[model samples]
Structure formats: C-alpha cells, structure tokens
Target: MRPRLLFASAAAVVAALTAATAPSATGAPRAAAAAWDSDLAAAALSANPAAATASGSQSPELGPGAAFDGNGATRWSSNAADNAWLRVDLGETLRIDRVTLDWEAAYGKKYVLEVSGDGTNWRPFYTEDAGTGGTVTAHTYPQEVRGRYVRLRGIERGTPYGYSLFSFKIYGGTPAPASTTRANLALHHP
Candidate 1:
C-alpha cells in the first residue's frame, strides 16, 4: 500500500511535468508556457479573506484588508516605524512560487519575506536589502516554499512614512483535487 501511494504521487508529478512540456499540434510550445515553467512564476492566486493583518494601521480605511481587496486606490499604511510588518494567512499549506508587492509612494527599502506553518515560527526565504520604490515589484524564489503564513517585515522605510502597499499577491500553488487526497489517505491508512 505504501509503495502504491508513492507510485501514485510520482505518477501524478510526472504527468503534470509532461503536460507542461508537451507541444501543441502545430509543433509549437503553448503560448502560456510560463504557467508550467517552474523557473518562472506565472500564476496568481486570489487573496484569502480575513487572512491579512498589520502590526499597526495608520487609519481605519487603510487597514490591512484594504491591500488585499483588489483595489489599487485603497492601501494599507502602517505607523511610522521601521519594525512594521504585514502578514497573510493562506488558510492551508501551499507551494508558494512568487510574491508581488504593489507599493504606493511609501515602501520598504529593506524587507524580508518570511514563511511559516503555524504562524509562530517563521523562516525568511527572500530578502530585499535595497528595495526600490515603485508601483509593482515581484520576487521569485529559486524553489517553491511550503507554508500557510507569509509575512513581510520592513527593516527600512523608503520614505519618511511607514510601509504602504496597495496590494500583496502570492502565486503558484495548485491544490490537489478532493478525490485525490481521499484516495491517498485511504491508501496510507488501509
């Protein structure tokens, strides 16, 4: 049974890889090749509700949820402090491939992206020592990371104000189908 489960997992991974690399009938790669190219982060996941929070909000309208609300006009602004941070809970563990920070005029000059399973202990996977203030900035890791909580900690501010973000997005985790997880569980428990 254990061997069968292992084989099933391996087969699924191989199938996904094959599908990602297979060419079209015209003998040309698919236009969305980046979707399957693990080297590039090509997909974006919707921000989970009630999963965002900040260390300190500058105003009620500029709360943490505003950044995840899909509106560029709304933003989350923290108090004027270098230790400001914002976090998002993904609800469950996911294979995070990339993170995008849509910044306003205020941004973090130095920040670290940390991930954790229980939200208590975090592991910093990516760090921007010199972040440039811009409308949009993206970071892709060399390999995917599994975590339920993602946090951005500001070490330095680009402006006199605290960190401000119009939106924070995470990409690249495809959850297994319900049937698949059930089958895998049966195989291991039977």
Candidate 2:
C-alpha cells in the first residue's frame, strides 16, 4: 500500500490559496500575494531567493534535505550517515501559524521541528515520537509566536534509514508592510 499524509492537508492548503487571492470589497489594488499553501514550493523560490541563499538551498528544491555529501558536511541526523534538512528564512518577522512535513513511506520513524528569529535562540515546535513514511503531521504554532527562520532537523528517520521528502510548507501569518519601488531599487543596489 502507498503511504499517505497524516492529514488531508493538501486540500486545506489549496483552499487557503484560493481564498487569499479571491478579491476584496474595495475593488482596487490590494495586490496579489501568494498564499502560504497551494503549489507554491517552487514560486517561493522567486518570492524569496535570498531566503534560499540564507538557508543554503537551491531552486526547485522542496525542503533542505538534499544530497550535500560532496562537501563532507555533517548533517543533523547521522554522522557520515543518512539525514537531511530544509531550513527556511522568512525574510521578516512572521507569526508562524502552521507547518507541514511530507515524506515517503520509507521514513516510518520520527523527528523534530524548530524555529528561531536570531538563529541562535531556538524553540521546539513539535517532537513526534513515531512517524510512518508518507505521512504529514500538521501542528498549530502559538499565535503570538514569531520568527524569521525555520529549520527542519531530521534528527531521526524510520527503521530503514534514508531520507524521505516531497516538500515543506510554512503556513499563514502576516507579511511585513508593502515594499515601495524606491525601497526595492535600493535593495538591489547592494
């Protein structure tokens, strides 16, 4: 049997995306913003490429846990072993509302989720004792909780050790104020 997500989260994600861009009462320029959900794992790259650089990630990548073995880099999982991570930089303060981790049936173990603004001061989001590969665990973060970066540490994988992945979605929260044309120009100038 194929593995499945712990929650019907994909549906919920699509719904949110639809709602955000639906339209407003003003009937003016409210601006279209990408919903936290939806099929945005790719679009997120364009929206925040610098974030990828900040997290040491590449394009078209779902989460952080890619094959970074070339540099002999040590991962959070095992030493000289199987493990991966998908860290994200929010670019600005955001009240992390929800998080979803998707993996393969091969990862029938467990792991941890941590968030931080300064990157040094960390806090645990959730610690699942058991995980079946192909499941997605969704958890609501503290409403007042805020951060600029999120690091998914695959501390442990399922029985048959390996990495499982598809994507990681950091759900809704308010984005910072609208950026002006002059500000955007200044940012590009170094």
Q: Which candidate is the best by TM-score?
A: 1
The alpha-carbon lDDT assigned to residue 149 of candidate 1 equals 81
RMSD of each: 10.8, 16.0
> Alpha carbon lDDT of residue 40, candidate 1?
21
Looking at model 2, report the run of 10 residues with the lowest lDDT sum.
Answer: 67-76
Q: Estimate every model's Cα lDDT from 0 to 1.
A: 0.74, 0.52
> Which residue segments of model 2 deviate by more than 4 Å?
1-43, 53-83, 141-143, 175-190
Candidate achieving the largest lDDT: 1
* lDDT of each residue in 69-177, candidate 1, tens digit only: 7677888999999999998887667777777788998999999989899999998888888888775444555656878888899999999998999887776565455
TM-score of 2: 0.54
TM-score of each: 0.67, 0.54
Give one digit per residue, the lDDT tens place, for model 2 in 83-143. Answer: 4455666655566667765554445265677778887777877777677756475566444
